[model samples]
Target: MATEALAVRQAVPGDFAGWLPLWHGYNEFYGRAGDSAPPASLTEATWERFFDGMEPMEALVAELEGRLVGLAHIIFHRNTGLVGPTCYLQDLFAAPEIRGRGIGRALIEGVYARARAAGARRVYWHTHESNAVAQRLYDGVAERSGFIVYRQDL
Candidate 1:
């Protein structure tokens, strides 16, 4: 499909039904699947955050032919080292069949645009080491930060 044919916009309340599967797919891609799925309460809370005016979290969706094809979630937060806020491209996913059709790029670019508008000095995200395909795209659009990630569940 032509890139021009795809529309990227802020997700609306009406988009919940369409966005659910895509959200699940994104979690699944990150190894959250079947019994490991996030509880409904957490998922619903995340969904609600997008519409909460006081929340810094936001969600964008890409639609083609009236059907949702991609989703991107971003969060704006304070950074001690920077004068402006930092924007984190938290989660991004394009439908499997439309993976290489520029959907992801559009979503990332959209996030960049939104970040800039929100006074964010930098926009960054990470992918699993195994996701070479996405890394290839990331490598083209943004430089690798050279910082490794560490995490611990409290």
Candidate 2:
């Protein structure tokens, strides 16, 4: 599908139904499905945060023919290394059936636009190293920071 035909915009409450499946798909891709899936409460809170004025999180969606096919979740936070807030693209996903149709790219560009509008100094996200297909797309739009990520469960 042509990128122009995709409408990337802020997600609204009415989008919940369509957005849920894509959100599940994203988690499943990261090995977070089945028994490991995130708690329903967590997902509910995440969705609510998007529309909460006090929250710094936002969600963008890509629609084609009135159906949501992609989603990008972003968070803006203060970074000690920078004077302005930095945007972290927390999650991004495109439906499996439309993986190569530029929906993901459009959603990413939408995040970039939101970051810029919010005065964020930078925008970044991480993907599993095994996701070479996504890496190919990431390579064309942004540079790798060469910084490995580490996490420890509390």
Candidate 3:
């Protein structure tokens, strides 16, 4: 499939129905399904943030033949080391059936364009070390930061 046929653009309210499945799949890929799935309130808030101008978050969707096949969510924030805001690609996912047709690449390029337009100096994201497939795509499009990730549940 020619990536040219894929339309990568800001997601609209109408896209929620199509976007939810991909969002769930992304979570499930990381073992966040069922008992560990994110709460509905959090999901609802995330969606609302994308449309709120006061928020620093945004969402992009990839549509092929009018069906959404992928999604990218980004956040822009001030960084102590950067003069300009940095763009963090919080989440990126393409449907399993359409993994290698350039949907992921196209959505990433879309994020880059958006980040550049937003006066961001850089764009970055993280993936589970075990996700070699996604890493393959990430490696081709962006450099590995070589930083280990750590977290503590509040």
Best by TM-score: 1
Give one digit per residue, the lDDT tens place, for model 3 in 3-50.
Answer: 667999999988899999999999998899999999999999999999
In terms of lDDT, the poorest run of 10 residues in model 3 is 1-10
Higher-scoring candidate on TM-score, 1 or 3 = 1
lDDT of 1: 0.94
Each prediction's TM-score versus the true structure: 0.97, 0.97, 0.96
Give the deviation of candidate 2 from the true structure as CA RMSD. Answer: 0.9
Cα lDDT for residue 43, candidate 1? 95
Better of 1 and 2 by lDDT: 1
| Model 2 agreement with the true structure over 5-118: per-residue lDDT tens digits | 799999999999999999999999999999999999999999999999999999999999889999999999999999999999999999999889898888888999999999
Off by over 4 Å in 3: none
Query: When superposed on Cα atoms, how far off is each prediction in RMSD?
Result: 0.8, 0.9, 1.0
lDDT of 1 by residue, 31-133 (tens): 8989999999999999999999999999999999899999999999999999999999999999998889999999999999999989998999999899999
Clashing pairs in 1: none
Off by over 4 Å in 2: none
User: Which pairs of residues collide in candidate 3?
Assistant: none
